[model samples]
Target: MISQATIDTVFETARVEEVIGDFVHLKRAGSNFKGLSPFSDERSPSFMVSPAKGIWKDFSSGKGGNSVAFLMEHSHFTYPEAIRFLAKKYNIEIEETEQSDEDKLNTDVRESMYLVSEFAKKYFHDILLNSEEGKAIGLSYFKERGFTSDTIKKFSLGYSPETWDAFTKEALGKGYKMEFLESTGLTIAREDRPFDRFKSRVMFPIQSMSGRVLGFGGRILTNDKKSAKYLNSPESDIYHKSKVLYGIFQAKQSIAKLNNCFLVEGYTDVIQFNQAGIENVVASSGTALTPDQIRLINRLTKNITVLFDGDAAGLRASVRGIDLILEEGMNVKVCAFPDGEDPDSFARKTSYDDLVAYLDTNAKDFIQFKASLLMNDAKNDPVKKADLIRDMVTSISKIPDRIQREIYIQECSRIMDISEQVLTSTLAQLVQKDITEVGKKVKQDQKAFEVVKNESPVQGAKVDVLYRLERKIIEILLLYGNKTEEFEDVFLKTNEDGEIENVIERKEYKVYQRVYLSLQEDEVELANPLFRDIFNDLIQYFLQNENLEIEKYLMHLNSDFAQEVTDILMEDERVVLHNWEGQNIIPKTKSETIGQYVSETILTMRWYLVDKIIDELKNSVSNEPGSDNTESMSMAMDYYKLINSFSKKLGRVMSRYS
Candidate 1:
């Protein structure tokens, strides 16, 4: 177990914005940073990071927390794993007890796969640097491709021996489970026995954004007719090839700093470009460009430049990729190398300065690239040219931004020597068609949601009342709990004549203290299990810590419960937090009215409870007419009168019968 002191140190040292900024491109909005939600597919910025509060909220996904929680949620790290990640990032020395054998046996499957993959990466790297066959073949091949030792090491390039089952035997000997080894595709398990899958191949370790080894891509040295040239790790729990970009773990910082991404096709292309002094480059790793991969890049940069080989296939891939990038609401530019030169070969042959200059000069907007590339094929053929025009319009229609679509249309019209009016009309037609399709999909989705809602066990105001009140109470605690406020206390005292007298006293106390005392006095607790737990935690924290770190509280919360709190806290952003001061609206701002708000919310909660009790009592009296229910009836009437008086004080109408 990690020591509490170490955990506290990690929390203190890790900055939420700094940690999240590694994966997300955050821009300052007011005192907080805002970006596209990393948890959801979104075009607009709804993800917020408050450095002052040391917390982040993704309004789209309803996930919020501090640095550690963000890491856990985004990377799917366990609590301990997240703590370790933060500790490592912040250079904090960890204090932990040695795990027993049972702990090793009970390690999670995904983490086990990660461990195996990491070990395989190290093993292969050692073989490449130290083994004779690896040096003769793998090291020689990389060196021949103009990769320096530093470059090879930076990308974790490695090699597997020619002998079958060599890696398998070593891995199994090391006590690493064969199940994980096979699952990560390092060793392929057959009916008879398991052998190395990437035999005699140079290895490229594909790492996740957080630099954990997810899988590998291996390139074969020998040109055997029967063997595939390139083999990648099969889909596993930790590695989704479609979602993993080859150089993302390396390129993330550069891409964020540059505010742009350089997209290439092959692993070598990415490595060579980084070697050539261009660091903000990644590859699709030979797969078709996927939305998941695009979203990954989108988190780091809004601008992407596709570097293509001057081959038909490369051009086709660029065309296919541009729409996906545009659909993500990103700016895309396309640049192609001279014929017979891919990015890998070109970067290797050209000087860094010359290559950079070439890319800058040759890169064209996607529209221009598409129009220019297809114009030749459509030349002097009216029919083919018209089809090309429609194709360009279709591409433009895929763009989510209206201004971008219009600008691209204008550029296409000017370049193709076509009328702006005609292009605009065609673009409108394409956009209308898209809207029609989207409308149908939305309607279908709404219908499905309605069906599900109708079938759900919990529905309507009966469910809403308890949850809304519970959530509101938590939100109050989260937002105003630490503030000192004046509260009016009401009590009963014995007068000099031995008669009961109503006594009112005003006192200043912290919001949390007042809320706690009020709830304690009334013997009330939150009904929802999650909210109740959070409420108890909040009270415990307040009692224990003199310095209340709301962010720390959120970070230490269970992931699911934290998300619910986030949803409640962020809900105000969707509505008016303060009452509008016009016509019949109150002039008090949220800060000025918070005391009243808290009081009203508490009273409303009590009123609801009282109403529920009254209903229960009435039901009891009606069911057991033979029994003596005079006391229950009197109790119900007393609750009714109490709730009515409370509601009147809050300026709310109470229907005792209803």
Candidate 2:
């Protein structure tokens, strides 16, 4: 229910590239931007952003849309939340109408989960402050751990009363669905009985990157040998433990600001770091680091410092995570506290400057760190030495970037006192073995999925050219929809014998109109639900504001589309050359080269379309000759006209771009 005026203002002021750049590390790739897919685990970048179009496409995932789409995919923001985020980012005020009871009832399932999670978080917070048992147990536990009131509230620390069914009864009394409670793992159900899952436990709300409570991690206060020290919410609709990190939402901005991240092993480690004035730190919640979790950190920063405990067992257990971090093309270093000290204890025991200095002095690149740690055990033992080398090579093989892999190999060889060639050969064999295994997996999947339609022609090639082009065009409109560009509109002219008048001179080239008209002949339908929704919304926007800037239109888009629009407008990585007072960057030779390529590709695609239609007509005529020949011939003429019109439009676009 945000006011249209506010939306318009946000769209006009908020740049898509600037918005998306906050989340995506975009690199310039020709006229667009590229980044690793946020939606999928990808080594190479398949997430593309066209700054010119203001849209992004995750080629790996077959998901394409504008900036709002990117936000929805990356952060899982609801349509309204996305717009509100953009509004806040751009300093635009939101005017929302109160939702009616009927409107509230029409919420989608995903939104319902979000609502339930939010309610649970509030309920937990209220209980922690208002309930006698909660205040004594959860609040006291956090205070003992040196958590200030602000920090406790910031992390949404809470407690469930010792009494069974306390939270469950309250939630059900408030009219929240029991099914969602069970699904969210907030309430456990056994036969005809149900009770609060976190009863008598200090609660730690697990959150998604956008700060939605997905699940909880709870600790038992009693020293019962039979009881597990900590318990986590069972995997639910919103919580996927392997795919989420503990402190991402809170630490993301600081991580980006510092251009580095500290990866710790536990929730308290993260909280302690943040409290101790080191905000760019997160933890895996004591779980082994996953590619998904690693990628999450990678999205925030390129540099990672794994904070390990000094104990040999702790360091050994963390080695696997370091290897995984390196394999993701990240700059990884390792740091260990003094014996008996973990990240939490160390951060609390020392001053910020002391911890910073210690990290700076002790942090070592993964290769040197790993080699030194392993070398100590392999002293004078050839068999152990060989095993260490093989292990190092295997870790090196996991790296996706050839340059990074080679650099690590050189370091490994130098540190391990081995020949570079020997290490290189071993690495190659490991990589080959991995590739073969992957190939085998692919073949097995193919056999299993034989009945499924193979949408990808080459498993990675563009599946639908028309869809791609249309999406690209929409992307451009979303990003640059308001830019004024000259365009020609043809009108017929006739003589004075009551036939027709001379063609009028018009100076109208509304960007939206041009985009609309450009695709009119193609009759392309946007396949993505989000894109389609935005497209229809955009058409309305255009009708209202002939002079609207693409930026201005962005505010009016649904929140999901707003995020996509913002991402597209803000995701471009083209570095504008500064202090170019006298430099002539547009060299004639370079311009000519680009022009030639554009012209050729446009004509090639157009001709391909034309020839395809012609071939289809000929085949149709041959296959059904009995149908009225004149009608068939007329239909063929219409097809020819359609292709001819598209050819002209393509030529125009080519000439304009050139």
Model 2 alpha-carbon miss at residue 392, Å: 1.4
Worst 10 residues of 1 by lDDT: 574-583
Cα misplacement distance, residue 438 of candidate 2 (Å): 4.0
Instruction: Give, for candidate 2, the lowest lDDT window spanning 10 residues.
Output: 573-582
| Stretches of candidate 1 exceeding 4 Å from the true structure | 1-5, 190-193, 449-469, 479-486, 490-505, 527-529, 544-548, 551-560, 569-658
Error of 1 at 464 (Å): 5.4
The Cα local distance difference test for each model comes to: 0.86, 0.74
Residues 427-489 of candidate 1: C-alpha lDDT, one tens digit per residue: 888889889999999999999999998898775575588788888888888888888888778
C-alpha root-mean-square deviation, candidate 1: 4.8
lDDT, residue 92, model 2? 79
TM-score of each prediction: 0.84, 0.73
Q: What's model 2's lDDT at 606?
A: 52
lDDT of 2: 0.74
* TM-score result, candidate 2: 0.73
Model 1 TM-score, 2 decimals: 0.84
Clashing pairs for predicted structure model 1, backbone only: none
